[model samples]
Target chain A: MSSALHTVSATDTLAGRVLHDTGVAVAECYQCGKCSAGCPLADEMDITPSQILRMLQLEMPELDDEVLRSHTIWLCLTCEMCYARCPKEIDLPKVMDSLRAESLRRKVAHPKARDIIAFHKSFLDSIRTCGRLYEILLIVAYKVRTRHLLQDLLMAPKLFVRGKLNPIPELIRGRSHMARIFQRAQRKDG
Target chain B: MTMKMGFYPGCSLKGSSREFNESLCAVMDKLGVELEEVPDWNCCGATAAHNLNHALSLSLPARILALAEGAGMQEIAVPCSACYSRLVMTRHELQENEALKAEIADIIEMDLALNAVPINVIQALDRALEGASLESLVVAPLAYKVACYYGCLMVRPPKVLRFDQPEDPMTMDRMMERVGAEPIDWAFKVECCGAGFSVSRTDLVAKLCKPIVTDAVKRGAEALIVACPMCQSNLDMRRCAIKGMSEAEAHIPVLYITQAIGLALGIDRKDLGLQRHLVKVALPRRAVVGA
Candidate 1:
């Protein structure tokens, strides 16, 4: 059970905005810790998935970005174990994703999991350029950004010898169409 | 039923997991189906797009589905579990929310077709060979004990996937049984192997994948079978790299379901891309009956 901190009010739009965008009602969660119990990476999170929802239930602030900056949001595997075990059928993964989107959009500080953000940015950049992910190029770019050049050095030669790494990325004919979609999505979001 | 399916190999299949693509093609050929490649398919946006922008994630997969429908494909088979999850989730979201669908339609510059249902390789093969003769195709019975690792993306978010039992999925188990391999009951079948974090958080991935690899081996599983390239990469390629596990202790061979099937069909190991694996693959010896 969560300690009493604040009371829920009608004007709290964080819960409403979440419900509007993702259809997940934060008020429905009873802080059973069922989600935390089932979460595989719960041990690594600064705040458990259940606790994150509890914050919204209390309506801490509309744009506090405190929960968004928590390592819990980035550490989530999006494996949906918590989502599967939720009695309220609350999609924790979706909620976490929404928080991550908000975190990125607001340019809030992601204290932990900076490597994940770098990898994600590199991955999307790869797709945006080639219209498809080029693993070899994506890895190099990620390595450069994260300064993890030495982690998987041993596996590179093996991957290449096995015909896994290609020198050039295959460009899809739908590249321009995909670029258009990216542009529209950005404009709409902005 | 001479079923033809449009195949969306995703980027992984084309890049790192070429063996998955090769084995799938060989197995499907034996199962009697033509896997027409979806032409001009873009990335499925995977975990990256969804976290940054909601519409880009849905629109990316929607574009691929729309292309499959345009190619006259009623069913699309995706071998990568991440891609499968993205595609199915996109459809689920679009179907449930009409406003989102309309917005996505405008962004992609096309109508979002709720049709062209996506199926993973396991389901696709099971459906194709449902009434066909499977015993005759088995030249090599995969007699060794194996663990079918579904990981999270394949079966989780069960409401949207609607493909198998979330906690205890038996599609791979049943399929492996049909092919003469004993599928072991393991705890991490639907567990997460730290997907997408493989590159970003190697230590975290190693930590997560350690138990999965150790438990399967501890249970006497000769090989840990997987459907997702990420799982295979994490478990197989990064087996020795895991923080806690030693080289000898964590040396179980991780295989794609298609490669395992190709072996049972007695397809040459070379054709199945067995040699591509990092942990040297060694199949158990067959017991001769008339010795």
Candidate 2:
């Protein structure tokens, strides 16, 4: 609970870019504490949701980088609980989402939350290839990436026995079209 | 009595939660609503796409909406809450920002009509079966108490989803009552089930699932009911790791709302995919036809 704002006048232009991109009124947050108070994952976050907004208000790129890289951004479930309870109607989940996108673009990874990053990357990779998720492949890819192969091992047998896990993903006819969309998105970003 | 609507059974329904897909189709088929699959549908970009790339999220869902529109469906039913949220949110974004919509169109390389609105399974059920006689359809009434868990995405960011009351939604509860199941009043109805983190952060998901599972059990709920695949998989599959849960408490069945409805409608247990759950599900004594 750092009360003093860490203002950095040098980063105002970058801060303006964030505000324009997210359309969040970072200044209107007022650090009312309502958002964090209602957030389900606030206790696990390095900085509270209210504090994230406060950092944005201060426009400190260094603090912004830390915030973006903290496990908090990836840990956010995007559940919208904070947004629902916020008096200012700030969409904390959306803010977290935008920050996460920024984190990816800047190649900033949360050391503690790498598994989440890996999972997200693996998920998008699955979509890019098959146009839809192949559950078995996604699990294997994630397990290989995280190297936690034994984790949730018991459930897989039961899932397979129960016919929940399909050995193959039904490939949609428009996979090439989907690949084109991903390419265009990445090209525009570069 | 027959009405046609497009069904977008996102990846989860097609793979991990085939039971939800089966039960929904079975229930709808019984009700005489024809659900045509939105042909050549791809992933909806879900939470991952949105967090990693803005344009990809919008483009992935926009393509599906465009396909639904091309097939002449004014509205399509997205059973998975995450997919429903992505579709609804993308549509909302496209409607608000013409520039972004144009950009997304350029990337997706398709002219989306943006008229194929998205509706969650519950909302779709309400519309298609409006005023239908459910009282006669209940061959096996689910008389036991259940907790209706909405999870997060189905009805949140109220302005964007605009589906149900964000804080204290009761659509699922009301639907439960139609099948003679009493939906208990609980605090964590709209709580987060730590979705998408099921594989990445199973520990955190178990911790987050604590309140929802404990509250339901503490409130005398025989089962927990849900619509979202992530919520179902997390709460059901991760029951072993949930804090303050005992073997007895862990045995509480996590049922899809559609599965519960399917039970009430006397659809065969096999047809509803009830065997697919990690936690074995057995209908309560009251749910038996001649009980």
Best by DockQ: 1
Docking category for candidate 1?
Answer: medium
| Candidate 2 residue pairs that clash | none
For residues B158-265, write the lDDT of model 2, one tens digit per residue.
877877799899899999998888889989999898899888888899988988888898899999999999999999888887776776588889999989998899
Clashing pairs in 1: none
Worst 10 residues of 1 chain A by lDDT: A1-10
Structural similarity to truth (TM-score) of each candidate: 0.95, 0.95
Residue by residue across A39-136, what tens digits does model 1's lDDT show? 88899988888888988776667434678788988988889888888888989888888888777876774757788898888999889889999887
Model 2 alpha-carbon drift over 4 Å, by segment: A1-14, B287-291
**What is the Cα-based lDDT of residue A129 in candidate 2?**
91
TM-score, model 1 to reference: 0.95
Could you tell me the lDDT of residue A132 within candidate 1? 95
Which fraction of the native contacts appears in each prediction? 0.78, 0.83
